[model samples]
Target: MVSASSSTSSGVLDGFKLVRILDQDPKHKSANLLGEFASTANDGSASIDQAVLILEKTHFSEQFYRQLEDPNRAPTSDGERTIKAPKLDAEAAVLDGTERDAVFAAVSNLGQNDVYTWLLAWLQRSASDPGDADVKMTLIRPATQTHIDKYSAQRRVMVYETPEMYARKVQPWIASFPPSRIQWVYNILEHKKEADSILFEHPDTESGFIIVPDLKWDQKTTSSLYIQAIVHNRELTSLRDLTKDHIGMLQNIKDQASRVAFERYGLAGVQEGKPDGNVRCFLHYHPSYYHLHVHILAASFTSHPGAVVGQAHLLDDVMDLLRLGVDMKQRTLGYSLGTNSKLWSVLYPDGNPST
Candidate 1:
C-alpha cells in the first residue's frame, strides 16, 4: 500500500491509499476494474449512484468468484499471480434510499456515450455472477472485438495543454479581446467602472462577478442570468490547477454569489415553499477561451452551453475532490469536442484519440 504522504500534499489524510485503480495492472485485476468504473462515472453519462452501484456490485462479484474458484490462489511463488481488490465494507456496497435520491438530483446532465455500453461488457466478463439474471443476460452474447475497438477509439483523449501551448496558441486571439469570442469577459475588464456591470467585488482575492448584458434576461420570467466571476490570479489556468487555497477562495465567492443571485433574481417572491434560488457555479474544462473565470448562472438555467460533462464540472464537486486527495492532473478526465472544433485537429493529430 502506497502511503498518502508519498503521493499527496501535507495535511491530507494519511489513511487515503495512493492507488491508481484506473490503469491496467496484472496483479490487481479488481482494483484496475475500479479505475474503469471511475472512468464511466467521469464520462458524465450515468448518475453517480448508478456508477457506484455498478462498481460495488462488480467488486463483490469478483471477490465472491475468487473465493469460490481459487480460495488458495494467493501468491505462493515468484511466478504465481496475485489478484487484489479494494477492501470495502459489505454495507458500503449498498446505497440507502436518501443517498440514492440525492445522487439522482445532483447528477450532471451530460450526454451519454458508447463507452458506457462497452464498459458494461467489460464488467460482465470480470464479475460473472451466475445467480444474477442481469449479469447472465449481459454475458449471453459478449461484445465483439470490433465493437470494443470502436468504443475504445471514441473515448475522450485528455490532453494536458501546457502553459507554453496556451500562451502561444490560445492567448493570441484574445489579445485584442473580442466580445464575440469571450462574451462579457472583455466588457467587464474594460467597463468595471460602470455601475450596472460590476455586481460584487472581493478585494482580498482580487476576484469579482460582473453582470453579462447580452446573456441576461428578466430573472422573474426566466430563471437564469449570465454572470461571470473572474479570478485575478493568473497562475491558475483551469480547474485542474486548483489548490486548497484556491478552493477556499472559490467557496467564499460561491456563498456570496448565491446570495446575490437570490436577491437579484426576485427569488424571494417566487420561492413559495421551495428553497431559494441557487447559484450554480461551474468551469469548462476546455473553456471556449482560456482564462481563470467561473460561470455563475442560476440553477434553473438549462441552456448554458457548458452544462455537458465533456465541457464542464460543478465548482463545488471540484472542491470536494481536492479535499478527498484526488489529483486532478493525474486523473483521466473525459472531454468531447465538435468535429468542426479547431481544438480537435490540434490535440489529436493521429487517427487514434483514446488517452
Candidate 2:
C-alpha cells in the first residue's frame, strides 16, 4: 500500500497562495509578498497562516558578459541594449574585424539605436540616484526576519502598558516565537549575510555585539547610512526582557555602537556628551522581529520606520534606567504595535480603543 507521509513540509512552491502585496521598493528592486499556504504541523495537524515571500532581484554580475559574448544569447538579461552601462561597454569592447563591422552596423541608425534609448532612460533614472544598476529577479523565498520588515508601513497602536499588563499579554506572545523564525537573524550574527559588510564587531559571545548596515539603508550614501548593532546574546529579545541582570550587556552595546559611530560615521550625540551629531543609536520596544538590535541612524534620515514617540528609545535612556536603580520589570513601558497584531487584540478586546 502506497501512501504519502503525513509530513507536509515541502520545498516546492507548488501551492503558494498569494494574499496581497505588503510592500515594494523600486530602487532596490525588492518586494514583500505576504501570503499563506495549507500545511501540516510536526504532529500532522493541518494549518494555514501568513508567509512572507521575500523577492529580490539579483545584482548585475559576470553572467552579463557571457550573454554579450554570444550577442543574441540572453540567459539572464532579457535582450541586448548596446549601452547597459559605461563600464560594461568598456569591458565588452569590440574584439575583431567581423565584430567591429557588426558593431558599426548596429549603431549605424542613430535614430533607432538602443544606445540612445538606454542613455535617455538612464539619465531620467539617475535623477533618483546617481549610478548604473542592472538587476533582474532571481531570488525569492518564503522566510521571516526581513520579510516582515518590508511591511513597515502599517497602522500602529501606541501601547501604554504597565509591567503587570506586559506579563499578562505580551510575555505569552513573545514566548510563542519559535527559533526557526529567526534563521536570518542567525545568519547575520554568524556572518553569513554580510561577512564583508561588518562595520564593527566585538567577538565576546555574551556581552559582545556587531554592527552592520540596516536593510532599509542604502550602504553607499552617508545620508542613508543607517546601521544597526545586535548583541551576541540570543536570549535578549526586546525591551520587555530587559532587567538589572542585563545592564552590562546593554552598556556594552551602547558604548561600542556610539564609539564606532563617532569614529567612522562622524555622527554623534551620546558618545562624548555632545548635544548634536548625525548618528543616533536607539532601540525599539516593539521591534519588527524578536531579535534584540539597536538602530543607529544619521540625522539626515527623517522618515525611518521606528523613529517615533512610542517606538524609538535612545540607547542612553535605556542604560540610564538600569544605572539609576530602576526595576525595568516593574516600570511602565509604552510602545506601539500594529492594530492587526494579536497583542493589540488582547489590549483592545473591544474593537474601539479608549485611549
Candidate 3:
C-alpha cells in the first residue's frame, strides 16, 4: 500500500500535479502500478475536489518489443526467458465487474487512440461530474487483443473438488511427473513410486522439494539451496484457484520447509528471522510455467532476479487473504518487468524502454 502524498512527479510522467496515494511495502518495489482509488476529498481539504495520481512507466524498451515481434527470435538459455505470461483466461478470471469494464474500455479504444491517454480523459470526466458515483477508478495495464477477446467471452464458473476425487484424478499426474521437471525430488514414502508422489509424510508435519537446479537463485551470495516443493494429490494451477485442502497443504509444506531450514542453517542462516536461517516460500500467480509448485528457498538465497511484485505472492499472505474470505483469483495484482524481459512487447507496445 503506497501512501498518497502531495508529490509533483514519479518516474517519467510529469506535470498534471502528481500525488502518491497508494501505500506500498518498501521491500517489494514494482515497476508497474496497479491501484484502487476512492472518491474521498484530497487530503481532507475542501479546496481540492479530486487528485489524480500518475505513475510513469520506468522499464519501457523498444528492442524488447521488436524481439517479441520476431517470430524467429532465438530463445535465451536461461529458464527465466522461457516463462511466458499467464494464460489470458487465467488473468481474465480474476477481474471484478468494475475492473472488467475498465479493461474492456481500454482494449476497445486500441488503434483509435492511446489507451492510457483515453483513460486519463475518462478519469477527468468522472472527477468533474459529481453525479457519476458509479465511475471506477483503477489503473490497468494494456493487454493483448487476444486477452481482450477471451475476457469478453469469459463467464464465472466455480470449480469444486473433493479430497477423494483429487486423490484419484490428480494424484496420478503428480506420480508420473518426470524427475527432470522437479528441482529436487524428496522421497517421503518408503516405496520409490509412492515417495515421489508423496513429497511429505503428513500434510501437517512433513514437506519435500522438487528442486530444479536449472533455475538460478535470485541472489548468488548465499550458499543455501533453491528449491520448490511439490504438492501431493493436487493439480492446482496457482494460488488464485485454492480450496480449503490447498490451504491446508500449503501450511503443512511451509511448516516442514521452515523446520528443515532451521535445522540446516541454524539461527545464523535465517534471513527474515534473527541469525538462524528461515525458509522463504512463495508462488507466482501466473507461473512462468504452469504447475502448482511452492518455492522453498533459504532466506540467505536471494530470490530469482525476475521475482517482481504482482508476479510473486508469499504463501503466508495468500493463506491470510484466503482466511479472511477474500477470493484471491478475483483481485487484480501489479507486476513489473526488466528492460530485457520479452513479456513487455506482448503486454505493452505503446510504452517503450525508458532507457
Best by lDDT: 2
C-alpha local distance difference test of each model: 0.49, 0.64, 0.44
Q: What is the lDDT of candidate 2?
A: 0.64
Candidate 3 to truth, TM:
0.36
Clashes per candidate (backbone, < 3 Å): 1, 0, 29
TM per prediction: 0.44, 0.54, 0.36
Looking at candidate 2, what is the lDDT of residue 101? 31
Worst 10 residues of 2 by lDDT: 103-112
Q: Which scores better on TM-score, 2 or 3?
A: 2
Query: Listing every candidate in turn, what is its Cα RMSD in Å to the true structure after a full C-alpha superposition?
Result: 20.2, 15.9, 22.8
lDDT of 2 by residue, 1-355 (tens): 1122322222333455777777777876666566667889999999875566545554554555664678555344335556445434543465423333321111111121321111011111323432322221211343454545545456766668888777887787778878889988889889988888888888788777898877787665666668898878898888766777777877776666656666676555644545245466788877878888989877667666668767888877878887788776787878877777766887677864674
After TM-score superposition, the amount by which residue 313's alpha carbon in candidate 3 deviates from its true location, in angstroms, is: 0.5
Could you tell me the C-alpha RMSD of candidate 2 in Å? 15.9
Candidate 1 stretches greater than 4 Å from native? 1-187, 190-195, 205-222, 268-277, 303-305, 351-355
lDDT, residue 34, candidate 2: 68
Tens-digit lDDT track for model 1 on 260-320?
A: 6656554332365432446677888777566677887767777665676667888899889
